[model samples]
Target: MDYAFAGAMSGLVAGIIVCPLDVVKVRLQNQPPISLTNYNGTFPTLVRIAKEEGLKGLFSGLSPTILSYLCDRMLWFATYESFKVAISNHTTRKLDDPFVHSGSALLSSVVCVVGITPLWVIRTRMMTQNTETIYYYRSVSHAFKSIIKKEGLTSLYRGLIPSFLGIAHPLIQFPLYERFKIVISNYEHHSKLEDYNPNKRPELSNLGILTSSIVSKFIAAVITYPHEVIRTRLQTQTAPLNKNFSNNTSVIPNIVPYNGIVKTVKNMVVEEGWKSLYKGLPTNLIRTIPSAGISLWTYEMILNNMKNI
Candidate 1:
């Protein structure tokens, strides 16, 4: 298979593997503010949801989640690789150098944001809606249709701004991972790793790569956390107000053109309170750490294989 296709497949597998956590994270983030009186911790909340909603609830938006993830990573890696190849024609530097890898990751993320936003909107909405009304979704398509029927097609793209902003996390981390790998390879003198094939075995002992991956992910998760909160808020299904001060009243979460990103931020802060802007932040960081670390590690491994092939 082609490298791009292989990356897509690997992303799909990773998406499926990690989706349960993603669903849980989304639910936690999109939920109404937790009453201090009601819950003890994140894990307990997760347990309560699983106990109440069952195992399937834990994997609620798996289909759209996987699709969006695969599509995003595929485009990201492909674009990154293509950029590296093009840059190679203009420079004599090694392709696996830290700069090259980081540059690729940054570039690829820009491409992915354009396409991935809609899918993410759908996934988050499905995950966070009231369970009773949300049950209309027999599958991913059904979920999407129900949203469109009631909310319009544009509803599926609700959090586009914050989501686009969130892409910077990957953009920052991927290149950082690339650079970290170089530092590791250099420290090991490259000969040891040269003989140990990534295709044949897991390279767990690559401390530099591991450390770099972990650090980069941690930094990225912290810096971009607000965007996660914003995206979740926008994507989450809202119950309609009993009365509308501005216009018609409805019993469903009606659409609001909160205008630009600034306006969106201001309205959310005024309407929901300042803390609501940071809703689900703790769950987001916890979820992002492992997901990002493993994904970056695999991306490097895949890139190494493509080079040798």
Candidate 2:
């Protein structure tokens, strides 16, 4: 019942529940035309992919998704908790220290972002690959192997630019989540009876859990969206590998260089139009809010249960 363990389980469960939507989002982002004509909704997308590509198509890249999240949740919760503890040790404030809480949350998010961005790159590629080659991966390991063989070692880290920039998820997400949690917890405390002790409160009601999650994640997604756009583009770019392929520098395109982060951003806006920046906003929002909400709810619920025991 450790909060960390619970959080991981919750995340895994949430990932499975929403993965189809994730596949849809990734495809939408990667495809140039950005068409939804083949599918009606998340469920419809799943059905259509199944009919056309079989069951494997629907669950393509699921293995990497699971592995990525397992690591992500552990680093996320542990780092946030440890950071908060470390800060409290240095400060004179009590448990309600807003600065300590928000700061810890922010730091934790960055740690997770840096650690998991590589896995995210692989996962995204695995999901968005053409349907014909969808079954190429049997699992996360298979996906990694295939990518390395075909795209080289750097392929595993295709999205590092935008992913690193997305370190803002923690800066933007955790503080808002903490604030929302505080608000909900405060409301519950005041509404209860004089003899009521929230310290011994039973498992959070499903409604409360869902409510806290939606509000926190929605706010965080809205704030951190633009960064999400940049990260996706950088991760999914088709720039040639940096390594020496047959020692031919001429093979690389000198006209459209993919060097430097700012240059990439400028290129995207200037060449591809401003709308290109927001390519995956719809899918990003659909994926982020629920993914974040379930993660937070599961963490809190598990943490509270363990503490009570």
List runs of model 1 lying over 4 Å from the truth: 33-40, 87-103, 130-135, 190-206, 237-251, 254-260, 268-275, 302-309
Error of 2 at 52 (Å): 2.6
Clashes in candidate 2: how many?
2
* Residue 224 accuracy (lDDT) in model 2: 63
Candidate 2: worst-modelled 10 consecutive residues by lDDT = 247-256
- TM of each candidate vs. truth: 0.77, 0.79
Q: Which stretches of model 2 miss by more than 4 angstroms?
A: 33-48, 132-138, 149-154, 191-205, 238-260
For residues 1-309, write the lDDT of model 1, one tens digit per residue: 355765676577668777766766666555443322243346776787688778777777778888987887788767877877666556765565556656666667767777677787777765654443423455677766666655667767777777778778877776676556655665566555455432232333445556877888887787777778667766764434333322221223424435556876786677668776666666666766666666656766776677678
Please give the lDDT score at residue 282 for candidate 2: 70
Tell me each candidate's RMSD, in Å, in order: 5.4, 5.0
Lowest-sum lDDT 10-residue window in model 1: 242-251
lDDT of each: 0.65, 0.64
